[model samples]
Each structure stands twice: as structure tokens, then as C-alpha cells.
Target: MNLFPDAVEELRLRTREFIRTTVIPNEPAPGERLNPAVRTELRAAAKAAGVFAPHVAKEFGGQGLDIAHWSPVFQEAGYSIIGAVALNCMAPDEGNMHMLELIATPAQVERYLRPLAAGEVRSCFGMTEPHPGAGSDPDALRTTARKVAGGWMIDGEKRFISGAAGAGFCIVMARNDAEDDHLAGATMLLVDMDNPGVRIGREIHAIDRAIDGGHPHVHFEGCFVPDDAVLGKPGEGFRYAQARLAPARLTHCMRWLGLARRAHDIALDRTERRELFGSPMRELGIAQNMLAESVIDIETSDAIITKTAALLAIGERAGSSLSSVAKVHVSDAVFRVIDRSIQLCGGDGVTDRLPLAGYLNEVRPFRIYDGANETHKWAIARRASSNRRREVEQGEPYRADVDAPR
Candidate 1:
């Protein structure tokens, strides 16, 4: 069942208006540089319009819209590459806010979550490590937090950390050597980005052009945090990260779905007008096939995301199986749609004349981040096999036909 209320349609209309008038119009040109001050002003304006942070709860000064309701709104925001930035619901920050709200202590909330929720401060989640470390395999976390005095001493390096440059704080993941199991040994520490021991190594210029804070290489050289800096339980870092990723990836899919839609629309407009071989592009059979395939991909991606969102809203962790399906399907689907759009736009698509090229570049990483598609596939297959084995042991009919094609 969907989670959107009957009033959601009205809300969606208002959201569309806000996105069109306030967000899209304010986005920087393709070649234009990012201006933090201008972004801040746009965020303030979005906050005033009552459309900021749709995914966050009301207690955090957000609209408190649930997944179903938020899906359309976020999709609308995705139309412009900078739409989420203007609304203050962009990545790293949005996911960080959710984690802090769920696990941060009262004092920690006041110190970090409050400013973060209010968009007064920004934060990043530091988990990705350099090669031979925690990249996709989180169990390979090399960062360590050792017990020392009244708190812990954190020392390690984090690579590809988003929002670190201008972030006020970071939710740092480190291995707790005290734990017997390395997976359970992980601990999340809230560290001030400006901590003396916390060094900003280098700014990585990612393919995504609209990212507010450049992804930074972060070094934690004996960064000490008090006992209170621990988020949730001491050794629940992996669990907390898993929980955060489930919804975070879904949100990404939702936003990127919108981006794909925008590309598709742009392509359609071009196809209807541009002529090739003495006929409009839209009259070509290949053009029609591409458009048709895009529609199917986008609609299917929407359905899968909506179903997963409903499961999440009811407090059921759909886990890696469903999430993996959504991730792989959506990632591939959106990429294909964007690719087709670029093809339809011809040389203009590759050029900076429109947002298509940037959209394609930004979505390229979806298959890699959160979790690699190949990894997710293996996990999904293993789980499915185990479930089938259990069913066979219990002498239950497998009913493979129900899920398989004729």
C-alpha cells in the first residue's frame, strides 16, 4: 500500500510550482561556478516557502512528509540539478540529519542535529576509505578508534567524503579494537570537522558539478572525541550505517528518477522539433523505440521505489534483497534513459547547452556507490538460495513458476 495521504496530490502541485518557480530558475548555468553564499540564500528562501527538507520530521523543522509523499516532491526537485541543494535536502546532509535524529543523544542533537536540521550547519558521513580499505567492503574499515583516557582517539584516512570542506561536523566510522568481531567492532563517532587533528587533505573534483561541498580527502590524526560523541551504541556503527543506507539509496533513486524524466522530456521536445533526413526526429522508428523504452524504464523504476518506500514506512527493513533490486534496476534504467536522451539531443546533448550531459555524468556513479551492483547481486542470490533451501527442508512447494516467466 502507498503511504501518501489523500491530500498529497495538492501538496505535489504546490511542490511542482515551487520547484519550477523557485528552484529551477535559480540553478547556476552549466559553466558557472558554485557560490556557497548564493546557495545559502536560496536555501533560506526555500525554507520560507515551506518546501525544504521534505524527508525530515517536523520536530527538526521540516515538513515531516513520509516516503510516498516525498517521492513526487523530490522527483520535482530533481528536475534541476541544484533543486535539492536549494531545498536543503541534498545528499550527505539529508542522510546525516536522519542518522543524527535517530541515534544522537539529546546533547549531541543540540550540538549537531539542531543546526544541521535548521540548515545552519552542514555535516558529512565518513565511511569510504582509500584503496585496500573500506571502499565498497565496509568490513574492511581501516580507521581505528582506540580507548584512551575519558574518550577515544581516532586515527585514519577517509577518501571521497562529501561535504567535508564546509561541513561543521562528520559522523566518523572507525573500528573498535576491543570488539572480538571486526564487523561488530565498528563504532560511529561524531567528530568536529575543524578538530585540530582532523585534516582536510585534498578536494576531489567529482563528475557531479552541482555538489555544494567538494568531496575531500580527510585525515584523522589522533582525533579525540569525548564519550558522548558516540552515536547510538558503541559498536552499532555498521548497523546504523546499514539502516541509513536503505533509505538513503531510495532517496537517491527517487531524485535521479526525476532527473531521468527531465532528460526524457527534453529529448522529446528536441525530437518533435529537430529534423533529420527530411523528417522530424520524432517520425523516425528508432526515435519512437527509444522513447518507448525510456517510458517503460522510468515507470517500472517508480513502481519498485514506491513499493520499497511503503515497506520502509511500515518499519520493515526490506534489506539488501529488495533494495538491491531497486538500486540495480533504477540505476540501469535511469542511465539508459539519460543515455537515450543524450542520443536524441545529438551533439547538443554532449555540449553544455543543456543539463543532459551533466545529468548523465552525475548518474554514472549510482551503480558504484551505496553498494556496487555486482556485490548486491551476489548478496541477493545468496539470500534467495538460503530461503529456497529452507523451504525445501520444510517440504513446502517452491512455486518457482509464480516468480518465473512462462
Candidate 2:
């Protein structure tokens, strides 16, 4: 658990201790999510402990850890649902800060990323829409933005927009068909949530209650923002999305892995104590196998996460494809580990008596979000096929042995 690099080892340990002592003590009752008020308090404590916003730059009031270094730190913070938010690293805020840091103009940075990194505000990334719209396929985005006299008019309805209810702003993805503009195609626009045209609808009330702001319906009707509101270049929304999502996916894996470890630990404690037929249950063969299998799952998930993190740290051109691999594998692995943990806990697992049920609900959506696992699998398969196609066309001899030409 402590194989982190020297630079991050102390911070990671501090983060774990912080979560165990500070964040876990403040966990809300079962089935209740953390509200802004509670989150504000935790953020203050995290700041005092120098553990808030580890991913943002120091100039932005963060600890300035890069993507590779974030693995253990984020994992520690994710041991409890409250921990990530307390450290100001929960989505969509965490992902928003990352995107803003990468793409925001100076004026935009001053207006958005500064307070966001300081934990003064929260934001949402509005990419997914209602059915028949974007969802897992962002290319199917339904939002539209048209050039106006001074700026642009945004008109669209985004559903299942995480943190939309109380977000200070939103990074909206809208298509611009006008080829005459400075740039066309899909565009990223930063829209203030308080804009006259922004409206928040019903809270989705999803099964998971751990996200700081519950996902909700966000409608943008005639919302207008100056041309200065554009994030990065026009026609580069998808590019910026990849910039945000690729690393965001890895971080999600990191956090969920921590939760999965917690679940495993809970099961381990129970098995060691439970007596069946006047003997310790954990000593039985089947129960022992379940524990061993979960350990395998957790360790493998960690290895892939570490590898993908390294690829990300170097800004590897293959990072996105590798991220897809990590996302699909880690997501499934975490779910398997947690499901087994719950089974090991027996009756107590399904009830609020243990956090296993909530953990299950939280991780179940991961497969569907950040691009569904099925979508990632299809993409990964295509990439492999493309590589093989190139090899075959190049007249390279095929081999059946592992790591050979075949």
C-alpha cells in the first residue's frame, strides 16, 4: 500500500491519516449525500492540513502534483466518499479544474480556475444530454451555440448534468455549424450558471448519494456569453474533452480503487471474526478463495492504474487508448471486488449496517459514465484491429507465440 514514489510518499501517508481521522468522522448518515455546507467545512480542514487540491498548480492555490503523483494521494482521499470532496478533488469540480487549467484563457483563468482551486466554487461539465442525444457518444451532442451580435447564444437541454444544481458555471459543449465563424464544428463555451437563461430542473436522485452535488437536468435557453467565454480554440471542444476525460478517467479509477480496498478490508475483518461450526469462517476453503480472488482483483487493478498513470505522466500519445483499457478493466475489477466483499459480509452487506451497499451503488454507475465500458471495449478492439491491419499490410510475417508478430 505504500510503494508510492518518494516525492508523494509523505503526502500520501498524510492524506490517508487525514481521511481516517478527519473525513471519516464526519460521514453523513447512510443514504445521505454531502451538501455544500458540510463540504465547505471539510475543505477548510483539508486546506489547514495542506491536502486540498493536490492536482492544481501552486499558483492556483494547490499542491501542484502532476497526474502520476496523484494516484496514491487521490486513492487515499477516496477511502471515504467525504474524503475526495474534503480535499477539493471530487468530480465535476476536480475535472473542471483540470480542464480550466489546461484550456482557459488568462481572463478565464482569473475568473474561473482561481476560485475553483481555492474551493470557493463548484462547476459542472455539460456534455451528456437526454436520451437520443450525447450520453456516452459525445459526437451525438444535441446542444447548439450560435453567434450573436456580441457573443453567442446557447440553446440546449442537458440532462444528468452532475453538480448542475449548485454549480458556479458550466463548460458546455455545443455544435456550431456556421463555417464562417472564426472556427466551427464542436465548440466549448464557458457559461455562468447564474446567466439569465440557465435553469436547473429536477434532481435525478440517483442510487449513489456520495457525489457532492446530485446530478440534475440543466437547460440552457438563449443563454448568452461574450466571445471571450470560449475555452481554448474554436472547433476544438472534442480535443479539450479528451484532455479532460483521459486523465479524469484514470483518476476515477484511482478513487474507486481506494473504496474497493476499503470494502475488501471490511470483509477481511468480518471473516477473521465470524465463527461457523465453531471455527473461524475465514479458515474455510471457499471463503479463503473469495478473499484471495478479491486480493488478486484489487492488486491487478492497482497495477494497471499505475501503468496508465505513468503513460499519462509522460503525455504519451497512446495515453487515451491506454486510459480506455484501464477504465474498463479497473471499473469491472472494482465492482467484482466489492460484490465479493458484500457476499463475504452476508446479510449485513445489503443493509446500511455496513457501507458495502452504498459502495456498490456508487461504483455501479462508473461502468456507465466517463464513456461506458462497452463503448471503451469497442474502441480498444478497433485500435487493436487497426494496428494489426497495418502490420499485415506491411508484409510482416505472423507468429503464434506470445509477443511475436502475430
Candidate 3:
């Protein structure tokens, strides 16, 4: 039997259909960016289909689906490159929206969350920065936020910020000069992108072109943001980031999982039709082995994502631990699946004749984003060691309980 409830199942099917039909048809041509007009049209179509922003609250014009219900729906929407775009579930807007809902004041929600959920504008999360700053290590954050009368002055440079180019505003992470501890001083602020002192550099061309507003560098020089723009409390940016990233990491897995599945489907279709050595490629022993490995990878990734999604839904103690594991495993597994599929498809895979080419570029960067797999692996190891030590001291059976790393 299917794991999802009937309503979730139905929503999943509808989302799949919407992606296969509406979103895929309007996807940008090879090497082309999605134009504004097409984006508007897609948003309108998704709204009409009642699938826009499925993860946001119903009061804010979204379906208000929880994390568990969102898993299948997001995967289905991920079938096409533009699927999440049509539904307005694409990040960093998706992640930003989630954060705002959890912590923003009602007025803040009205100003930012509502418009964002409605797909009226986009947003970015500013945390990553150039070398010598907070690229992988958040403690290395150099951006400073100093309190001023009636406002705050934010100063720093952020690089490789996704969705920053065209975003209306950004949830900026900066160090609070008031606090002595760098980590404790970090804060989140909502700054309008158009502020006089906020300068957005040209988009940084990246391997992945699927995300709108290509990752860009931003400079905040004496950018004055009102006191009301602080997200949550002044010193809780890292905490809030952790809350945002856990779910965001899962959603990224869900989307890439769908694309990886699609890659395999393309390869399978090619194998069935192409003749090699007087037999269909699918009949070859080597081809079968590749296909089997891909199947296994996809199945494993799906199982982990599903189980993790369920755990997250129920707020299980092991949920965060599982999410980190899922993020690392699924990201790598999906990449392998796409790679094998590309090999299986031969020339067609590397070409635009199939989706594998773009998918490779799209999935490659995932290994580095969210939290790097290396970093996650390090956290996982530490957690395991700590858990083992505690269990041994208590004379209990060996058990590991780990939470998501901040």
C-alpha cells in the first residue's frame, strides 16, 4: 500500500500531471533563461490549477501542506525543471517563506510573507560570502550590523547568494557588533534589495541555471534597515538558519530526486529502442547492470527521503540526524543516478536531445550547497562518537541519537 494518505496521494497525482503537461511544455529552450513574461504566465497557470506554493499557509494563498504532505507533492512538481517554478515552491523563496511563517510578526508576514507566498515577488537568503568570511563556516561571518537610532546599519559583502539579483528583499545574516562572541552576535535582517546602500553585482554564472536570479554577489555599505526588519531576535540568526535549512535541505532532495528519476526514465527508453550487437541495448549484460545500479540508487534515495520526511513531520528525536544523512546520501545518490543514466544514453545524454545534460549541471552543485556533504559527514561522525561515549558511560546498549548540525 502507498504510504501517503488519500488526499496527499491525490494532490501528488495532480501535481505530476501539472508538471508533465503545463510546466514541461513551457520550459526554456536549451541554454536559454526563463523570461519574465513566461514566468508570469506560469505563475498564473499554477494559481489557476490550485497548486501554487503548496507548502505555504492556506491563509496566505497556499495549500498549507505540512512537511509530510509536501514530500510527494514537491517531488511530483520536480519532474520538470520548471515544475517548482510553476508552483512557486522554488528556493530560496520557498525556504524564506517557511522561515517567515515560523518567526515573523503578523505585520512582517503581511509585508513580506504574503506577497512572497502569492508569487508577487522573490527573496534571497544572504549568509554565504566570499573567502575569509562565512562561506562554509558560519562563525567566519564578517558582515556587521550595528544598532543605530531607529534602525541598524549593515555592512559587508555577500557572494554566491542565490536569487539575489531580482529579489525584492533578502533575509540577511550579519554579525551584531554589540555581542562579543561572533556566533552569538550573528543576526538576521530583512533588507530591501533596492535600498540606497545595497548594491547587487552582476549575476554570477553558475553551473546550475535552473534557479532564477542567478546567484550573485551583494554589497551592503551603510545599508540602513529599520529596527522592525530584524527577523526573530537580534542574536538568533544562526538558530533561525538551522530551522530554515533542515526543511530546505529536504525539499532540495525531493526535487533532485525527481530529476534523477526522470534521467533514468530517459535512459531506459533509449535502451529499449537502440539496437547493439543485434539486440536491444537493454538486453546487454553491462547495460542491465548499469540499470540495476541506478534502480537501487533511486530506490534507496526515495526510501530515505520518505522516511526522513515522515520523521520530520512527526518531530521525531532522530529527525534532524536523519535529515543530514538523507541530504548527504540523496544528493550523492541522485548525482550517481544521473551520471549512470548519461552513460547509458551515450551521445544523446550529453546532448540536448535528452534532459540529462542540463540535469547534470543542475544536480552537480547540490553537493556543495545547503550544507556541504563533507561538512555533514564531519558532523555525523562527531554526533556518532558523542552518542557512543554517552551510551558506554551509562552501560546501555549502543544507540546513536544525533541532531542536524548548525
Candidate 4:
């Protein structure tokens, strides 16, 4: 596939213009969240501009762009912090929308996916739990879902759940002890936030402030739902979650890539306008080195993100592993780009005087979220070593789907 799809060029350009003209001007102040009214207003403007939900399918009242199309469009929306929110493409919701569309039954789609895609309501994915529970380790899941007369009774606690406060519902992952297959014992269930057993705790104070509702702690005590609430097949939650994570990770890269680029642009603008020692700062060799480094980081990041996006589009098994690599590389690269931009801007970068300062705060958290960079590094090394052994023993080229002999 072409690096830049010709068909989505207009939509991508439109999104960039909208973000530059509409969204950036209305960025919420540091430590301040966007009010619901303002969010509604921005969403309306985005819908009117035809850039709303550009990655969602047309059947769901979205722009119907595929993963390839989303790469460019999401990057454009990332230019402004509110750009993704205005376009209704922010995470948890965006990722949940993808999950439901792929696995939700027709009824589940009608009740959950449709409204979410249309931006009628918000949603969250309940996965990471407290220390004693599941955080990073899916096998440590303490949440249990027992089969009941009509449905399942779920009991668990989830922390750092983004958008849980005002969310209409959540896609909860829980362990099913009844299943025979160890890997298949985990299942996903749809639970309405209004359910009696569902309790939303205080919003976690995180470094980043862009996500709606912030991240909240949640408790599910005997949460009951009908059989229809099951997302796909019972005991297949882990598989489905993996499906969601691969693309979600890439989307994160795409959005952050845009933010880093924005930081670079702000830095370049500042350097060009500010003169030091009777010459433009950008013309100075020191400043030129910083600019050159940022350009390399940005280009390398784009190459990895685009290549990974292509792999995902083709349904390659290596896509998942590559996505992990992309997540690690792009997250760190983008962080450097933003950090360099901050240093280049000097005092203005640290202060909220310009967008680079805030972008720095925003991009910093990306390394930890969506599977920590260190975790990805471990996985990458483990997989590479295992794949190499298999190649040596079998005298064959390494393939993504190959599993090391037990």
C-alpha cells in the first residue's frame, strides 16, 4: 500500500487545518480539564467539519477510514491536545470502539458500539488493577466472573481506568475459573456504569491531563449482567485483548508522533524568531544540531509507525511483535523529540508559555502506558532470542508465528 493513501489526503489535510484553527486555540489550561460543555462544543464542530471519528466505519456514523487511513489522520489530530478529543478519537473510547466493532454481537453493537462511535456517550476498558490484582501481569487477574442463572456475577477492582467517571459503560476483563483451557479462561463482559454494583472511586491524579474524566479507580462488586453482555465467546478475553492492544499501541504512536512534531514546530518557530549574539538562533551550529536531531527522530518514528501500520493492515503475525517494537521505539523517540524541542526553547519550553511545555508532559506518560517500554524491550529480546534458536535448529528463516519448542 502507498505510504500516503491518495483517498484520505483531503480528510487528513482537513483534520490538520481544523486542529490548527479550532482546537489549538481552545486548549485547556495546565492542571485544568476540559469541561463537558466545551467538549460537546468541540465535538459538534468536529462533526460539522467532517473530521469526526475519521477512523471509525461509515456504518457506525464515522468517516470509515481503515488502519492505513487512520495513520495519517490520527497524526494530524494529534497536533493539538484537543484534536483527538474533538474528533472523538481519544483512547479508551477509540480502543473500545475498535474492540466492540470486531467482537461485539449485533445486540451489543447496537447498545454499546453505535453510541460510542457517534460520541453519544463515553466508555472505559477495565483491565489494570491494584498491586495485589492484575497490573501488567494478566495472569494475576483477581477479578472473577462466575456464571449465574441469567448472566455472570463479576467482582473485582480496576485502577487507572481512563474515562470511568462519566462513562456510560465499561468493557471489563475477568477470570472465568470454569473454563478448561488456561489461556481461554479469561473473558470480557460489558457492564453499564449505572449498574448497582458498579462503584467509581476518585479520579487518579496523573501527570497527563488530556484524557477525558481522567483515570479513575473502579470497583465491581457482584456486578450482574445478562448473557448478552459477553463480548465474544466466553474464555477468550486474553486473545481479544491482544487483538485490541496491537492497533491501539500503533494509534498511540501516531497521535504522539503528531504531538512531538508540533513541539518541534513550536521550537523551530521560536528559534527562528529569537536572535542571539546578532544572529538567528536557528542559524547557529548548536541550534542546527538540535534541529537536525529532532528531524531524524521524527523521520525514524514515522518510518516505524507507518511500517507497523502496514503490517497490521495485512494481518501479519509479526505485526504484533513489530507493534511492540514500534511502541518502544516511537515512544522513546517522540519523547526525545519533545525533550529536544523543550531544550531548544530553553525557559519557554519548561513554562506553559508555549505548547511544547505541555506536549512534554503529555508525551512523557506514553512510555509507561500501553505496555511499558521496558516490558516491550524484554518481550522483544525474549522473542528475538527464541526465534533465532528456532531458526538455527530448524535451518529455516524466522517467522513471526513460530513458537519456540517447549
TM-score of each model, in listed order: 0.94, 0.96, 0.95, 0.95
Candidate 2 lDDT, 1-406, residue by residue in tens: 4666676898888899889998998898778877667788888988999888999999998989988788889989989977888998988889889988887889999999999999888899999999888988988888888887888888988988888877899999998856447666788999999999899987797887777567999999989999999899878898889989998988999999999989999999999999988889999899999999999998898888888888888989688789999999999999999999999999999999998988999999999999999999999999999998799789975665855653
TM-score-best of 3 and 4: 3
lDDT for model 1 comes to: 0.85
Identify the leading candidate in terms of TM-score.
2
lDDT of 1 by residue, 140-228 (tens): 99999887789889999998898888889999999986543543578999999888989999888788766667788999998989888
Candidates' C-alpha lDDT: 0.85, 0.88, 0.89, 0.88
Candidate 4: RMSD over Cα atoms? Answer: 3.9
How does model 3 score by TM-score?
Answer: 0.95
Query: What's the C-alpha lDDT at position 398 in model 4?
Result: 50
Q: Write the per-residue lDDT of candidate 4 for residues 180-210, one digit (tens) a residue.
A: 3553478899999999999998778888888
Model 2 gets an lDDT of 0.88
Residue 133 in candidate 3 has what lDDT?
93
Pairs that collide, model 1: none
Task: Tell me how many residue pairs clash in candidate 1.
Answer: 0
- Which portions of model 2 show Cα errors greater than 4 Å? 1-3, 179-182, 400-406
